[model samples]
Target chain A: MYPKSIKDLIEDFSKLPGVGEKTAERFVLFLATQKEKDGILSFSSHLKEMTDKIVKCERCHMLTEDTICDICKSKERDTETLMVVSDSKDVFVFEKMKTYHGQYHVLDGVIDFSKGISPEDLNIDSLLKKVASYKEVIIATNGTVEGELTAKYLKALLSDFNLSITRLAYGLPVGSDLKYADELTLNKAVENRQKY
Target chain B: MYPKSIKDLIEDFSKLPGVGEKTAERFVLFLATQKEKDGILSFSSHLKEMTDKIVKCERCHMLTEDTICDICKSKERDTETLMVVSDSKDVFVFEKMKTYHGQYHVLDGVIDFSKGISPEDLNIDSLLKKVASYKEVIIATNGTVEGELTAKYLKALLSDFNLSITRLAYGLPVGSDLKYADELTLNKAVENRQKY
Candidate 1:
């Protein structure tokens, strides 16, 4: 009703992120040029299906179908040294590093007081309860201002406990020689250095 | 295992008509950034559904579920005149005009001898048969060499029949005055003018 099929399809494609009107028109033209067997309309249905299905992991707040994520279910992971992150993608980043052996806790979002997001808005309370049983908890939040505030809030919440709580150090990366490190990074590395 | 998710997704997106590696990368990244509740992995499944579903109109060769298209099934329209077009979208153009009281015949494609497409390849026999039952048949193909050639071929094919066959008169569009018309369009309009 909005338009005949072709125009309607173009309008729909244009609504997607990064697809402009011109690009939407072009995509529709390209789609129409395809042979009947290509099933362009069915593709729209499929898009709706993907958007409708799929579940997020309950334990870590990452995307997963099971009640617990693969990392949470695994016995080989270091459950006592949990890594806290803001998003699920960060978990993947840590996994790809092959260095972190600990399980993960995803906040799903960073705490932003300006946007009205407080500690309660994040999964910090559950993380604190989880940390009560562990010997150590590592805050692997990003080095941004929001991340720093979230980590500091978390540190205060756990200050009464005797467990070791560490924030992922921000310094020059490995193999990035001291000479090539940016001034701020070199300065941080110098300031945060532990006794040899 | 070879970044199974990202690698497979990149490969699949890259296989689309005009998507290159960088665009494919961007597409995968966009999908990856989406919430897992959105079923990003099921994008592949959706692609399969599109290719497997959707039907074409048997009568007009347009994308439709029924044998006869909505235009052909409408009883209020005059069935005497048939506007012959190359694809389904052309029906939209004519529908926008709302001046003609005629049904449509979608040819699907024009006769392109250079590409080995002959009169038989474009459902010309069906068009000729339909023209026999019509008072007039209008050829509304694009203003290209191939379109013209196809129109000429249709005229020759329907020469022995007792029906009037006409092509859309080439000219400047209705909104444009003769002063603004391109030289080719103005010349064509003048050449094809009828007595008022």
Candidate 2:
């Protein structure tokens, strides 16, 4: 068994998205044993600093230090094109590509009835208010069932507006062998094959 | 790109063992966005608490809240038998089995030449001082190359003392099928087979 404070820290770490009790224990012990005397102290200070400074961007619902995110504030991005994503990390993924010049709107989470998340729980009111200004709305949620459902729901909501709503195309991932491709992915790839 | 404090936190998380930059980013984002407003603040406080409290046991070199660990302080333990381990975690593992009622001596680390970790860097000085009181010294380090090397080194050093030095038996792990066992494990199991 761990010391009281160590056990408490492990419990806190276990609350993170993917970390389990064993992983949390490993993390805590590594910090306690492996790091320098001031390592954990500095790490704790950094956590405090992040908690004090980071806030959700008012316009896009993305994590930012200021009221408006850098992406939302930038004038160079194509304001007419908006990419809707489930979480803020997706924004970074798109930005890393260096090709998407459009703005982003983080929904915070997708609609999952099983988890009791509904359309009203998402950051959609402001999205609906600003929908008329965008020429195209790209639903760029993940390829999961919840992502598909959210994309479909967003499409229906934005159908009344004079904007083209589109979902990301489904296909086999790049560099993946066809032999290992699943039936659903193969079906979609065949259905949406390019002329090339 | 992440904001200043968030980026700093991510870097700190990345320093943790087995955590990469992407996983660190996910951890920071999850802490910042998914958790309640005070979650990160509380987590930081807990880290500070752990740093302020936990200390290494004077005798065994295991992490504990007091000057001596519970195991070292306990009169119920078999002080004549000592278990020499590579890390403090190994002590906990042996304790959980409830079969080993011996005292423990944490070496803190194994003799890793690649990492420039020599026996001098470990807590072997105290071990050498106290090993004479024990009737048996069990070298319970891991099965890795470094662990075996450390065990051999300890055996040579402790050979001067009156105590009997022993190594843990190597064989297939419990609940593992023979077909699934690796060649090295199979070889070790065959070489060290027990009598029915």
Candidate 3:
């Protein structure tokens, strides 16, 4: 129904995480009909640049152009505290907050039995080597089942490390209405009620 | 928040319709972290190929690799009936139905007054020349304000030509429930009700 190049582009676009065929078609059409004659060419060059330049940080497995990411190389960060997250994107989210001064260790993925992902598949070995020096290890993975499973596994593994291990607190989010909160969230909120 | 090349790629992705900063971030991350290392590079090369290959049909303004589109060059198509559409994507949609055998004239855009897009910005002059020989001209624009405006303006411009001009029927879509139909759609359905 579309030209060969357009169809091929749509196929490639569909390989992205959340893009479907319809959205891919729209994206390809936008590139094809864009008023800027050099837009698609520039976009192609940018993709090539990303492919040539981007690399993973050697120590933490986070995305960076250098061998070590800026967060890992920074001297201002709190070296005693380390946050363990499932993906590099989570590190970016935490960096946006600008509150946490701790270092990050990207696991690349979590323990998901359903998907056959396990501790060995993650960066747990490197984390074990690094954990002995940190005073605190915060498990900052998502609130999903895989995240909790990974945290539990890590806690048991790091029991002998003599460092305080903590997971992010569960409660109703700020600016959220109690009525709309799910039962589990409401329960967590009640259980973790603050001194205030 | 992201590396320079990643940020540049994200900015380019954000230019597409319906893509936002967050979605663009995800797309770049997907390309960066995909298991197939050559994925992003292949995608870049494909984009270059599209830039070099895709061209518009000389007669109808539809996208094609050659000087004339397949539909415009086909001898089996009904030359007597011409469908005027707002974009090439619309022509693809009609072709997918496998029912419409008429030739198409892509306006490339509609008469969007708010956006200052007039008939001159469209392929109206060529349409005026082609409508004379055709027995029927179907205004197959969208149901939006711009689409209707373009259809109305074309109707007046081609009124001098000796041909039957028709717009798509306004009614409840097939398989849609009357209870969920909006007031305007219900009104149009009632006014255009057929003899059952």
- DockQ leader: 3
* Candidate 3 local lDDT, residue B66: 92
Off by over 4 Å in 2: B179-196
The candidates, ranked best first by lDDT, are: 3, 2, 1
Best of the two (1, 3) by lDDT = 3
Q: After superposition, how far is residue B49 of candidate 3 from its true place, in Å?
A: 2.1
List, residue by residue over A123-188, the lDDT tens digit for candidate 3.
999999878999999999899989989999999998889899999999999999889999999999
Docking class of 3: medium
Instruction: Give the Cα lDDT of each candidate.
Output: 0.70, 0.91, 0.91
Winner of 1 and 3 under TM-score? 3
| Native-to-model Cα distance after best TM-score fit, residue B184 in candidate 3, in Å | 4.1
Give the poorly placed runs of model 1, Cα more than 4 Å off: A1-54, A57-59, A65-86, A89-105, A112-119, A126-196, B1-54, B96-100, B112-116, B159-164, B168-196
Per-residue lDDT of model 2, residues B1-196, tens digit only = 7889988999999998899999998998888885576777889999998888889999999989999999899999989999999898888678778899989999999999999999999999999998889999999999999999999999999999998899999999899899999999999999998889
Candidate 2 docking band: medium
RMSD of each: 7.8, 2.6, 1.9
Over A1-196, each residue of candidate 2 has an lDDT whose tens digit, in order, gives 6788888999999997799998998998888885576878889999999888888899999889999999999999999999999999899888889999999999989999999999999999989998889999999998899999999899989999999888889999999999999999999999999998
Sorted into a CAPRI-style docking class, model 1 comes out as: incorrect
